[model samples]
Target: MKKVVAISIFLIVGLASVQAQKTAKMEFKSETIDYGDIKKGSDGLRVFEVKNVGDAPLIIEDVKSSCGCTVPTKPEEPILPGETGKIEVKYDTNRVGPIRKTVTVYSNSSEPVKALKIKGTVIDRESGS
Candidate 1:
């Protein structure tokens, strides 16, 4: 009886692992983007490129910014296996000074939720000090 139970457990675990192997995966070109130094109110936009490196389709459900100053947008359609997608991030450069923000991406990929980073410095033109 013990042997039978062990076999059943092993079979279940094996099936689960097989299913996980077919799930969608997200592979980003770079997890972090550095804008370096920029003048206030300058173009504060960047794109995070990712690839669907799994056997299934990658569906990005939502993209949330850490604060109001930063905005993130995800692709409208699902990313098929071996395909690529982009996440556009727009930071408000109006607020001068150091910038460090995070964007959380929710998807159906292996990593259901992932955090992306953006950091840089914004200098005010008026302050010219």
Candidate 2:
């Protein structure tokens, strides 16, 4: 009886592992977005394109920015396998200076969590400083 129980448990565990192998995969068109040099108060919105490369639906759980100056938005709906989605990020262009930020993404993709980056400078053309 003990031998049968152990075998049953082993089979169940193996089946669970097999099921776990099928999951969503997130593939980004580019890991970084460059805002380049822009004038103050210019449009700060940018998008990061992503694709679901795995067999399952890609569900983005959360999107966060490293600093309050930057805001990141994730897709509200699931991205089906082979479909594409967009993650929008907006940086406060009012702050005049070099811009460097990180956006973290949490999702059901196989990778679970991913970090994206943005870089560039915000220039105040009117104020020489």
Q: Against the true structure, what is each candidate's TM-score?
A: 0.83, 0.85
Q: List the pairs of residues colliding in candidate 1.
A: none
Question: Which stretches of model 2 miss by more than 4 angstroms?
Answer: 1-18, 127-129
Residue-by-residue lDDT tens digits, candidate 1, 38-104: 8998999999999999999999999999999999999999999999999999999988888899999
Worst 10 residues of 2 by lDDT: 120-129
Best by TM-score: 2
RMSD of each: 4.2, 2.8
Give lDDT per model, in order.
Answer: 0.94, 0.95
Clashes of 1: 0
Tens digits of per-residue lDDT, candidate 2, 1-129, equal: 999999999999999999889899999999999998988999999999999999999999999999999999899999999999999999999999999899999999889999999999999979743
Candidate 2 lDDT for residue 51: 99
Best by lDDT, which number? 2
